[model samples]
Target: MENKGNSESTTTTTTTTSTAPSTESIGVAKDGCNSSRILNINVGIMGHVDSGKTSLAKVLSTSLSTAALDKSPASQERGITLDLGFSSFNVDVASHPLLSQRSEIANHYDRVQFTLVDCPGHASLIRTIIGGSQIIDMMFLVIDINKGIQTQTAEIDQIPQESRQSKIDTMSTKLRKVLEKTCFSQSPMVSVSANPGVVSEEANVNNNQQQQQQQPLQPSQPIGLNQMIDELCKFIEIPKRDDQGTFLFEFDHCFQIKGQGSVLTGTVLKGSIEINQTVQIPQLNLEKKIKSMQMFHKPVKKVVQGDRAGICVTQLDSKLLERGLLCTPKTVPLLNGAIISIEKVRFYKNLVKTNSHFHVTIGHTTTTAIVTFFGNKILDQSTPTTKEETGSIHQFNEKIEYSFMEYLEPTSLEYPVGSQFALIKFDHPVLCPLESVIIGSKLDVALDTSGCRIAFHGSLLQGIDASNRQILHDTLRIFKTKVKEGAVERVHSEDTLIGKNLFSKQTDLSSFIGNYLFGILLVSLSPLDYYLNLLLKRVDKKTFL
Candidate 1:
């Protein structure tokens, strides 16, 4: 895991090891000088299992001279990325003397650093993949060129339709159908074989180090690897970060590094944390002081927003601080928001109903959230500046609400995310960013049903307590009373008038019928006594005659 840095060019290293690859060589190389600042953008590689996302990430890292970050023991054993892996490389196309004179490249593409995030592609590890995707600026979807797209691309409708002539009509061209309601809906894609024969010499393989092991792979050049890198560098736009907001950091991995004590490695999500600064671990409910900090493997006084770095902290067990933990300033209070209201929710199919459950991914963490409310939500619509973003205390306007008739029913599938919003309530409290909620449904449910699997995605505007539901109901009633009072009054008056007229027109005929029926069927009055007298009289008369 050795990486070298130079004043002129960036260098990367690669090898098979137990430790994660350190991107020490990527920083100063990006700027080509000590004074300039390099822009760092996070990119994630995502696709179905065995789509070669890990290999592609390694190839990109090798091309850039930074060590590839794929050192999971289980992943090495299984030959697949089972967890989130990170690799970074500098791409300063304009830094080269030949391109520096060009206005376009110098103005925009100069000194850009990319943190390549390689996420696991297994369907079972979808949550991990989601966790990876949440942090990245954009996604690079990898698909097997030979296989085209796999089953997870779309829920192939086995139910025969009039449009399809055969029972097994799987059009690979229609794989794009799954994109409409996904977080990666409009993402860029690359196609390669699961075991692409072209493995660059620099791009080392896991090797046949286990049972039935084979010889190490020959150092062959990747076919489309360079072209992919060029396109990525050109396509990926710089992401805006909160350097002035709350001092927040989302650590994906934390472990003891022998002499380093406890090292937490992750990209800085917002604001800045200086050396010796104490940061609060929301999940642990404790504040720990930063003993030391390093960015790009170099010691720094402070780590600013959007930079990837590792920090050694005091008074904390590294094992306990894994992915999904947030380190923020003690001044910022952790929000207890279980009920999140979402807007701009885009669903693939079917109207999202209240009380329905869907998977929610927020900042490299995934969980289930129940649909608490749905409808056209009216919010303040005011964007938050950096100063107001930290430990945000949202004072929602009392008039703001999901108007009555906001529910999305089966009959109203026309309304989508932006047109209508949803209020999702998670099972437990979540620390979601200002706007980072992604919602999607599992495809298994649609296997027997008709339509797409993705449900909806939206950001958390604000949260509400379940206890406030009665107040909302009362407000809705008041609004309805004011808006449609005349219509309601007319219907009530008409109903009362009709009831009075019907009762007045009818007469009582029960007494006469009861008297008549009693004379005929009374056993003690006529039928039983007449039969007994007739039997005795007939027998006596016959004998007398």
Candidate 2:
């Protein structure tokens, strides 16, 4: 990959390489200028209203001549970056022991690229933030000095833990299956242990405790933050390949330390940050050195992703550092504008009467921008065929009227918001690559049963010739079909079986994912189970080649 940088422009060269390493490489032409390799780091800049995310993004990107902020004038006039901004700065990865071995590592720091993302800072846009946060490396929460840990902050605290747990649970289950298979291969006749099924048992018990904890412990109960953070660490995925991985930096606050002029505090999401490392704030034209660092209160030689650290920088002042600005090593690409493919969104109410400016939050960062819904158009309260510039437009043009609001207008304020009516194309790019996509529906249990049946049948039809695939796929499909048909058919077949009696037993996606994984694990461990081996042989006869 070759990249060129000039006073006015910078270009990046990226290619997906095969497993084999090639001599073809990205080179820089600028003499004396150090070549920097871009590191992928997803940093979510978040804060309350007026926390200075736009100010910070400008300073960070201006140094590079191109930043996301440059694309929109609305950001400058409002003094608020209403859309998520992306800018890359090079950071020195040489200090990282793993990266130092690469000859090109040192050259990469001079142009350390940081993707500057600005998110909406209000509570209304939390869902938008969550959508991006699921994909990013880490989150940078900007805490306003005047107001510490606002309601938004408190709300965010629960999210990291919840998401972390879900990931951990998912990973743990996967790991357990792998281990179980390995063990079965080693010992062919091992008995299935249900007695304190170590991992599974602990998870079950802990899950109960977690449910209790979520409900709010007794006032006297000992709930520790460290314990929660420690639990979160188990799920946090670290880059295994070392070089081509991502890191996260959650900037909680920016301030002027007594001795050091400008400083920031946040936890590194994945990679490491070292002293004297140059950090770039693109909009500020400020490239500063880390004078010192401290993690978990103790002064440390360096900090890595996941470690909360306090950083003191040279040159930039506290005022110059804003909420959304990210200080990154030069080798990473600044998240510029992204052409996101978004599934459609349908509003539930009359959005023309409400606020025109809909908020977009990516990770912890917040921005307010126009959400143009692609697809169909609907009528307003006046039932006018004319289009209004009030809210995001939908795909449908027919004035279809339905009572009982189920969808939300892009302009209408709603929670747990989602859409499927059309594709959404952001006017400006946000941090993540893909737009929020809604899968499945939230209909009644009866509908869920039928939906699962439909999903499973679709999967089965796609794999009719393959025996194993057929069995597995057919089993799932049949399971759902049975559930739905039984509930409905049984209601009349056996007067004893009532729809109301079977209403609460609907299966959802979670069950689907779990069951699918469990089936995979059983097949992977077939050598240990004679019954499974026999099952496989029979199923393989019908496999689709």
Candidate 3:
């Protein structure tokens, strides 16, 4: 009788436990784990122009009507990526070693979507490259192993072979170190033929069959598309997402959708946006509510960090929106007049001057800013607690770790310092981890390196907000009030900050000297005033008498 009772009790307990909900179902839905998390990464393919940028991106096109190069009719004839191209493909997680041991899809085979950014390698389109870099996680520096180095701006044959080769080697070393310091320990470098001919999947299969019939192939031979894909996955690291933070989405493409108003798509760099939620375009100062949202071209309830999503917004026209803008949550405010620090790559030729002007590219938004001499400290130096407590302030070209402050209004305060490197493209800043530079310019000419059409990359140190206390408070003061349509349209223009002394390319020393000399001339000529001289003479005669 005792054994029977024990068995019956145990069976009942087991049944109750099996019926209980699993902890894994916390954020998941009845359908599946799609809503729990997204597996997507943004990758940038960078190199000199004509280094097979668009061709490489096309190699990874997701579909037939892909977002590849030659979007412009002119570029089609030229065979170069004129502006910028974006394409994505699904990569099986089974191909790369999974870094996370506790991934939800460990047991099941999962696919990770990679969004490829194809930047124009031409110097003329460096601005576009800078904008694209702001939203990518990693980069593939493509170089032609057969050709020395070629870009539209560079004439490699004109320069001495040995000298050019040595300089290229030096610049490359510096870029690789910067990439390792900023992006990850490994910077993926791929060497290809001068002109890599494209082969279709069908062709590849037939070639494989023929090869098998002909002879046995060596395992180490690197003569296929699989080898290229493997190199990309070899050292790629997944960046952590901030789902709990305020929602921020960088919009690179916007188009009109039939029956759905305007549809905007880009990578979600932070937080989450759901249908019916209100979002703000901080740059445009436009407030909008999310009418509908789609992920992977299907309607989804929400779009989380790292997922490439398209949002259909109501009460707004498609004509008003463009690239280099963002959708942020209405609850959290965007950055205004923040003082960020920067660390340039080791071989970055142009040294920054105080109040020196730079074109900053932060997450696709480009703006002009001036550099200030904050103090001499390494990496990100902390501000002093009190007036007497003098802490270190870093400047440009200082210590391997130096602290310099950059005062730019309307900057994104999402990323942590040293986490993303900033790329300067013809006075534009792009987001980063450090990497190499390959230039075909002459080494002897101490050319004003600033104007050179080359991608200059550096680490962005954590910035201290030097916003006008009164202005910041005033901004919040207005936010506390009820917001209506077109309420906060002038935030950026209101506090736009070019420092007081930023007359660039050359100093205002001549002007200052001229002004001083004019003052002296006025003082000397004032004593010669006829009436004033007579009065002074009379006073002097009276004193002498």
lDDT of each: 0.51, 0.35, 0.45
- Runs in model 3 with CA error above 4 Å? 1-38, 64-66, 94-109, 149-223, 329-336, 377-545
lDDT of 3 by residue, 1-545 (tens): 00000000010000000011221221111222343344566777776655455554554554311245568678888867876576666555533444234255444335556677777776656657776766677666655332323333432221222343444455445445544544333443333221222222222356457421222122121122343455544445567767776777777677787777787877687788788888887556688888988664567888777777778886667777676445553433333323334333333445544455555555555556544433332233353322134333222232233233342111122222232222122233322211212111112333334344332333343321334435433432111222112111121222221123223556544654322100011134443344433444443323110
Candidate 2 overall lDDT versus native: 0.35
Instruction: Please give the range of 10 consecutive residues that has the lowest summed lDDT in model 1.
Output: 2-11
Ranking by lDDT: 1, 3, 2
Give model 1's TM-score versus the native structure.
0.64
Question: Which of candidates 2 and 3 reaches a greater TM-score?
Answer: 3
Cα deviation of 192, candidate 1, in Å: 6.3
Per-residue lDDT over 1-545 for candidate 2, one digit per residue giving the tens place of the 0 to 100 score: 00000000111010110121111111111222334233434445555645444433433332221225535576567554454445433234443333344445444433333344556654444443443443345444333322332343322122222243344344334333533533222211101000100111122356456433233222221112122222222222333323123333555457775765676765464456677767765445457777888632346666664344567776666775445434464422323222121221231222321113333444344444332222223333333321243234233322332222222234222211111132122335333312222221111223212111100000000111223433433332111112322221222221121223322456443543322111212325434455544444444333211
- Residue range with the least summed lDDT across 10 consecutive positions in model 2: 453-462
**Candidates 1 and 2: which is better by TM-score?**
1
